[model samples]
Target chain A: MSTLNEVLTKNLHGLYYGNRILLPFKADILKAVIEKSIITDFSDFSEQAEYEIKDNRTEIYFYEYADLSEFITTYETIKLIVVEEGRDIFDIKNHIKLILHLNDGHEIKIEEAGENFLFIE
Target chain B: MRKILPVVLLAFLLFGMTNQVNASDFVNPAALSAEIVNSDAEHSLPPVFMVIPFVTLLLLIAVMPLFAHHFWEKHYPKFSIALGTITVLYYLLVMNDTHSLLHTLAEYLSFIALLASLFVASGGILIKVDKKATPMLNVIFLLFGAVIANIIGTTGASMLLIRPFIKINQDRIKPYHIIFFIFLISNIGGALTPIGDPPLFLGFLRGVDFFWVFEHVWYMWLPTIIVVAAVFYFIDSRNNDGQEKSKEYTGQIEFKGYKNVVYLLIILISVFIDPNVISWVPNLYPLPFGIREIIMFSVVYLSYKTADKEILSSNEFDFEPIKEVAYLFIGIFATMIPALQLIAYEANLLGDKLNPGIFYWATGLLSGFLDNAPTYLNFLSAAMGKYGWDVNNAVDVHNFEIEHAVYLQAISVAAVFFGAMTYIGNGPNFMVKSISERAGIKMPSFFAYLIKYSIPILIPIFILVWLAFYYGRV
Candidate 1:
């Protein structure tokens, strides 16, 4: 397996925005991500809705930036595995959606506030 | 008010500097207009003293901010307008040069309109990046900012991205990051396209092809960007302690204010709406501006009025940065006419002795100190004059481009790249510095930025570019 640093330095193109580094995967990596079943959806919308990957409390949202057609098609194939796992996307306490730790001794807390996402950094 | 008194006395001082022009001259304006504005008339060159206002203004810009920050903050607009008025009165009363004055006014209007519209429009859109501050990630961000600078202009890209950049590096944020941002994104990045920098836009207005700069300067620009980015990467890596505990990251990115994107597109498209480019576009001649400027100013008003308040608040959007640019640049544009004319005369007289290398250094060094846009114009006027061509004439400008592409390339690259050398070199450099300072990033003083960062980091890269591209090409 290629290291995350190698993938980042070489193939993967990323633009940093909001509370996440948007990693737009392409071709072989996209295929590997699908075939290896790395990103499993956890929502009931299943076939029609957006795709996301759950890793601990961090939720990578795919409702933005990525426009690759394969990204859309990969959603349908990946939804079934997520249903089998029966994992909840929102399992964190106090409605805190995400927590980001900065190198300069700062912290960013992303919370779900009604229809809005509040970022306390 | 007390402010108006000095301005009026300064106006009298300006008139006192000039020879007598009777108030009765206004009654029969046609004779004065015919005598001055006629194409065939042989006018005397602007006296050397006329250049003082421009030089004084530039000196004040470089010195006052460092020495008298509070006073400069409160009265910069007054200073700018007063100096600009001196030049305007000198031209109108002494030199009787309405044509040059009018032409310069048109350029200034176009310049400010484009900058203001981009500023207001980009102010509405906010990008929020939630990522760790790593050397690699920072390099990528700088690289991306450079690319986008060509599209939205250095001003637009800097305003849109600087906030997110500062936020992302909040914990590890240092002065070097902001300085590199000023160097790469606010200056050198804009060399590839006319939309990228004010100097190139002025060149475009004067009749250089839109893609001409990209074609000529990209190879040089790419290598320069690489060298600068590499230096930044090395510096950044050493600064990294690698002690932060790894936290789970979702890689989330949020972008707000989609309407501003459409507004940006409109601004970009409007750039090509000049009657000079499209035949159907109506020419609003005799007036100092055109259809393009009108559209730009309209977008400025509309974008600000309709912007989302939440996005504006989050970005800390205010008109102060653009206002400073507007006031300062109006002074620069007005005062530069005499200097440009004098330089053109000298360049023509010494055309044979002056080569591409000489033009390159002359333009580069001056651009680092003076506002790069006018410096670009000054050198361009000089170069064209060397070929016995006029910068104001479209045919002459196009012909000069065909005959002397290398000189244009040198001036174009130098003006844009060397602008990174100082806070006053480009409009966005100051804006970025102000924005960073407000965000609590202690930016370097003017001399410190030059002595520490630009002279050390940029000069070597610029020398390499010169040796590679403009060495012995005359």
Candidate 2:
């Protein structure tokens, strides 16, 4: 299993390169992090952590950690499954779910709620 | 922006005081009208019944969208072409008027060429104004749009600016903002130059000088723009409470696809490459299209092909709008021939009884209802007939401008200005409305547009223009 940082690096690389959809806020932060080399081995990120595309959805599985600061640079990816790619978030269906496997064996889901993303534990 | 207003005002004052150059200083008006009446008897006119196709097409254009929208939208091309075919067949089989058909076809080709090139070129340009929306800024934007309409044409300027206009005013973008945009940018702004509007361009095709409209209409255009913009400023200021407080603006203006500016200049320069204007320019007679048209159509292909894909995607550029214009205008140009001939004959019959004031109201009202391009030509044909000149003859058209400046001015002003009164009045009005609606603005309905916005706002302004310039003038 890849480390949390490695998984996030893969996720960011996959989202930034593979997928066309990027949250405007996260896109800015992701750009800054990559540009400043705040995350090491970012250039080689695609080799480690991999995201899965299943059915109509993009499934990115990552284990949750204790400190929120560790996930600060981790970009929240909202995959628009029902709508066409590159459409605004407002046009998206509510079924966008990002599953987070927690350290204590509990799973949490982050869902798109209207204009924002909602975290449910 | 603030500093430019005083200079514009001073220029307007100077233009208003400048004495107009009259080329026909020796020609007597009474003798000319009498002579025109006598000369009209030589050519046998088309039967009045032949005009039904043109009228039917216009009526269908107006009512079908309101009443039979689905049917209209699905099969407008068929109906438009069918009606046009009837008129063309009648002219060919009955009247045997091949010359009228060919001439109109030439005008149609030229018309579509200019519009298509401008539409294609301007589509590649994306202007982003990242600033807080203020009433003054909005007014200035509208004024700036008015000035450039002459350069890029109203259709081009509308396509380039409407999206940015909406984005900047997204927080407080009301339907009136769009209505005023249609008024100033789409219609009224184009009055000062032939390149600005379709009707004026048609005048140019028939042989009006390129600078003639500017020399005559600028004094009138300036005050009208100022007044309408002032009214917009007043209304915008009153409705300024609802902007989002959290949003920050960098106040930077960005332009993408700057290379298209060179293509735009190419189109502008091609406007003057007419055989009639430049003696060296090859005429290519009987072909209906000259060197000018060839250059314009080439630009349409070249600009679209070479345009930056990113800017094209951002603007959501597509051929649908220009395609619609091309198909509908082919029908409009074809059908209007009979109506123009009949109207011209009758106008010559009524001679001096039909004054500049009558031409103003008639052209203005009909233009508001029917397509202004055809209405403009119909009235222009009428005015030319009243002067005993054939619209087909370039020399007659040239002389008509110099001799009967008032009537032509009235028709020209009314055709360009009153087009803002209705959506169907001009091409860009509907395009602006559709684009605004796509952006989530609930634009007023056709009647709602007339009753609530245009009738109240534009009518008073049009009346003021008439009073200032065209009132009681023969």
Candidate 3:
């Protein structure tokens, strides 16, 4: 004959097992998605949100991009320009960080260094 | 006689009452000792069935992001908290002891300290190396990362070098480029020392000599680097299609927030040295937890507070990745207790027969899915238990370590090296991916990464390692 205690212990173990596997992924799913424009909400989250790694900081300047996978209503040619350093972070050079299938057919691109630093096509 | 019998009954009842009153003061020492043993046993081996919270948490991390993105993002934290609460409750109520749960949480403290401090400190660095994107140059950069990964630790080295690697190849990256980078920088490069990977750090904590990895792994280390680097060079050369390296990025290289190096040094020293470094009276006892964390975190805070705003703005540092790791890993650490226990139990069940190669692959394969830190501990325990390595005896450990060098080396190499097999394998893999994606490179999905690179490039290399080192030895 099984006791109530046995049943309860079994059930509690179930809870432990269940929660162990489920909780971690639970809190973190929405934040993981990379939408078409990551800059939309976080554009103003912090000042100079670029995490400094070394002697220089990496800066991004949004340009034109189009996510065909996304609804065309939100699909604009969104481009981002990243400048490595200096107060001229806003400055887009003769080069456009072109994205042609860089986002798996979605973002930075420069064809030919130096001379073709500007897009000829 | 009848009158006397009634009186006697009254007297008997009164005597029984008196005895009952004194009985409260009596305790059977044997019974008391038995109860204590029972209490300790309550926490011993949680039902192996209790792996739900851990497995569910990881599976959700693995599958949910791909399919139910919205729900996962919205309800994940709630679900995690709820599940974590349940697990804690099980330990408290069902197990009837808090020691195991408390011990697990303590490991988490060090675990988070290592990850979080690295997260904070490494985020402070923004490395900018200006090499033309030639195949040879890329190979050199990878080699540099491989060496420094041993020095700064994988997480530190990955954070330090990822951006520069991305920037240099901004124009010419194929899917394979980042894939190879994960292969070499995040995984292979971390094989030489305890500081290089979390698994080795855990081993170091287990009294494996800090230099043991270098002494044993050097042969494995040099060849793997040579082969992987060579393969990367070849693939890069063929893929370049005659595209030339850049010359215009020729300005004298500049660095900002160079002071964070001191902070990183502080963090590393804390990891390496004992907490007795903080003793006021100079007595020779190690504090349970060191001031390394206190000093490390303070440096992270001060770096942010004092650094120029431009430095931060330029770097685009965000908290999302670290937060994700923090939240998910708690579940990982908590739920994985039983799994770790199961491995240990199974090893014990095997009656002390052990194998070096099997341990290597087993640890590696499990590390591919579960966070490698705990998995490393699992197989390490299995190995230790099989050999009956008592931690308190320094002579025993030294003898066992030297005698079982190959087995230890296998576990160490497998845990550190195979972490590149998936995005979730090591601490730095996903974050590196996240950072790269943010910088405008689209890293492949988790499974895509496995099918394309890990299974193809890394699996074979692992097999080669197994064949050469562990084939007959196990």
DockQ of every candidate? 0.01, 0.03, 0.03
True contacts kept of each: 0.00, 0.00, 0.02
Candidates in order have lDDT scores of 0.67, 0.65, 0.59
Alpha-carbon deviation at B399 in model 3, angstroms: 1.7
Off by over 4 Å in 1: A1-121, B1-42, B205-207, B241-248, B388-403
- Estimate, for each residue in B1-474, the C-alpha lDDT of model 2 and write its tens digit: 342243223223212211231322111110111222232353367778877877787677667767875466557777767777777677556655454555555556666777788888987888888788899999999999999999888988887788888877866778899999999999999999988987787788678898999998889889999999999999999986435456777989988888898999899898878655567876564355678788999999999999997677555465655656666666766676656666556665675688888898888987886567656766777788766787657799899999988888998999999999888788788777765653446567677788999999998988898888877887
> What is the C-alpha lDDT profile of model 1 across B1-474, one tens digit per residue?
453464334333333322233332222111111112222234577889988998899888778868875577668878888888888887778767555555556566667777789888988887777777788999999999999999989988988888888877765778899999999999999999998997887788678998999999999989899889999999998885433736555567789999999988999898878765676877654445678888999999999889997777555566666767777777776777677666656655676788888889888988887667766776787687677777767798888888899999999999899999988788788888766664545667778898999999999998888888878887
lDDT over C-alpha atoms for residue B322 of model 2? 67
TM-score of chain A of 2: 0.23
Error in Å for residue B211 of model 3:
1.6
Q: List the residue pairs that clash in candidate 2.
A: none
Scored against the true structure, residue B464 in model 2 reaches a CA lDDT of 91
Model 2 TM-score relative to the real fold: 0.70
lDDT by residue (B278-386, candidate 3, tens digit) is 2342222121123444555576677666555544534555555665665666666566656666665665566266688788888899888776776776666567656
RMSD of each: 16.0, 15.3, 19.2
Which segments of model 3 are wrong by more than 4 Å? A1-121, B1-42, B241-247, B275-289
Give lDDT: candidate 1, residue B399: 87
Q: Please give the ranking of all candidate structures by DockQ, highest first, separated by commas.
A: 3, 2, 1
- lDDT for B193 in candidate 1 is 94
